[model samples]
Target: MSRSRPGNGHRGLDRVVSRRRLLTGGAAATAALAVSGGVLGADLLSGASRPASRRLVESQPAAETAAPRQRTVPTPAPTSAPTPDPRYPDGPFVPGPDTRLWGVFEPGAPSNIAALAGVERAVGNPQAIHWYQSWSGPGSELDPVRLNNVREYGALPMISWEPAHAGWGTDQPPYALARLAAGDHDDYARSWARGIRDHGGPVVIRFAHEMNHGHFAWAAGVNGNTPEQYVAAWRHVRQIFLDEGAQNASFSWSPNIAYDGTTPFDQLYPGDEHVDWIGLSGFNGGSDLPWGGWLEFGPMFLPSYEVLVGYGKPMMITEVACTENGGDKAAWIRRAFTDALPNVMPRFQVVCWFNENVLVDWRVQSSPSSADAFVETAGTWRQRTP
Candidate 1:
């Protein structure tokens, strides 16, 4: 998503993609467009591309060139933007933990993928790689063999999902995703089915995550949906997908972890039957935070993760980022992911990072060199490549 500046909210996926995660609602998977303003009021949280950095976005225009150079000095930590434009004005969306210094908005080419391998080596594991997006049809597909190859590297396809970009979740907020949730709902689900079938495996599907908050129209609170109404809506959408038979998919009930206040994970819920997993997303900023506050400070993001223990199902940091800019930037990231170790392990299934530049660039703390280490330790990580 390209930066939209102040008053340019009329665009859609066709124009540019602005991937954003809020301090409260958080962001989305590869190439996802996040809406801030308490969900429906998305305009408050994110928009299209604002600008780019020389080293991160500009250096690796394609995935092949992915890799960041470590600085002798920390380089004052980057001043990250929540949403930065895609390098190619018009290209497919691809996200991954490769050579791109700042974020995945930049496509990962062969070189970029190679850089990711280096990171995997550093982390000491390379079983599977996220393979980026799981929703988009063709290029988004991942075959069994490809899956195996990714795993050979140690990471797995920690695929992610969104309600569908048809209406409200587009470039601007307060639009109409109602139609997407209702009429086109099954169609939306079916598309995913085809992709998974094509990929040939059981996949992870996080549906209308953070529904309690209001950025996208698919959720209950947004688009004028009441809790009960939204529940019904979710049931409808989920049922349609089940009917379409995306059997290879597992459902995850993800929500923004909470930054400003403790997000009432249970209240915004659509109920047990409608969900099989739980997750959190939050980036309430702190100077003490990493990645320019796109990621929250302290173990600020941890409480929400701890609360999911009662859910019984596996948990995931569906989207995570930190903005702290002191100490070893890469080491800080390693600590962020590693420290969360199993506070979260039993309840955990996967963890992914939002690659879009937050109020600034995507990679605030991670250098291509640093990323190599992080990628190795994680079971699965995803990226969006265009």
Candidate 2:
């Protein structure tokens, strides 16, 4: 499943609309507001107004004349007051200095560790392998073969746990968050947790990823799900794993970078006790469709990064990729490692590229240039300690 812009709920629309209205109304309206002398006047005519005025001038039509740029006066810093820190201080997962690389290959049989090894040979060795499994069936059967295969390849296993039986974009999810929180799925959760415990190695479980988006059934306000219910369900699952002696298994609380307007991201958080790592899913659609554009990696992740880092948890770009369409795919890949990974996202401890060909060609080898970029970037990061 992919994190997309289709169901984003117009989050950036309000800001865009407000700015457009301010600019299109012309400087005469700005002057009128300044002369009005109230909250609007105080705000617009303040020292902070230089940037806003510059943007307004730039937004004017070609035929219309714009006001000259005004001098920018530096604003004094605000007084620092002693306030209680609101962060959840105890983040469970704390990775070492080196960021782990990971990926998901083709689905079904081709997605096994052996196939992933082939990808590693082509690109470079990733420290982890990301795969998905569903809870549609009742059996507690675990895939020891695949898990062992991953370990043998010197990589860890990262599982995207889907509670619902349906595929992505399904309107109604059969498994509701209320049901899960109420212990309807406790037996299944325990069975799965025990299966992992019996396997006896470190594993990362990313349950109901992208929950902030409306596309998932477990998402808030979907199929009778709410943010509170999502939190409840997450806590219930984590407790079950703990009770089942799944100490080797760590929990990842993941949400899509963009969320539906109705539910804030903080409301969906399951708190520090239940969460080990903070996972985020983001993608650059890269002009494959009308809604998709060739977005850089930094901008796509910054919004979520700014919020999640406050929790002081180890961060992971659990799912990320840009399409090899409309723009320079090689440059995007190059910048992701050389710029975004090392500089823009210093808090991220792991990054898993979504290498599937679904929706758009997200494979690292979509072109030779892209593949080369991956190899080169992976080489640079591999020298660090994990």
My TM-score estimates for the predictions, one after another, are: 0.55, 0.72
Best by TM-score: 2
Supply the global lDDT for candidate 1: 0.40
Q: What residue runs in model 1 are displaced by over 4 Å at the alpha carbon?
A: 1-155, 164-182, 260-263, 284-298, 324-331, 343-346, 356-365, 368-386
Q: Model 2: residues >4 Å from true position, as ranges?
A: 2-94, 109-111, 137-141, 168-174, 259-262, 382-386
Model 1 TM-score?
A: 0.55
Model 2 per-residue lDDT tens digits across residues 228-276: 9988998899889878877667778877675325256778877766777
Q: What would the per-residue lDDT of candidate 1 be over residues 226-292, giving only the tens digit for each residue? A: 5565556556655665566544345566766554332355555656666555655544333443323
Task: Return the lDDT, model 2, position 320.
Answer: 75
Report the number of the highest-lDDT candidate: 2
TM-score, cand. 2: 0.72
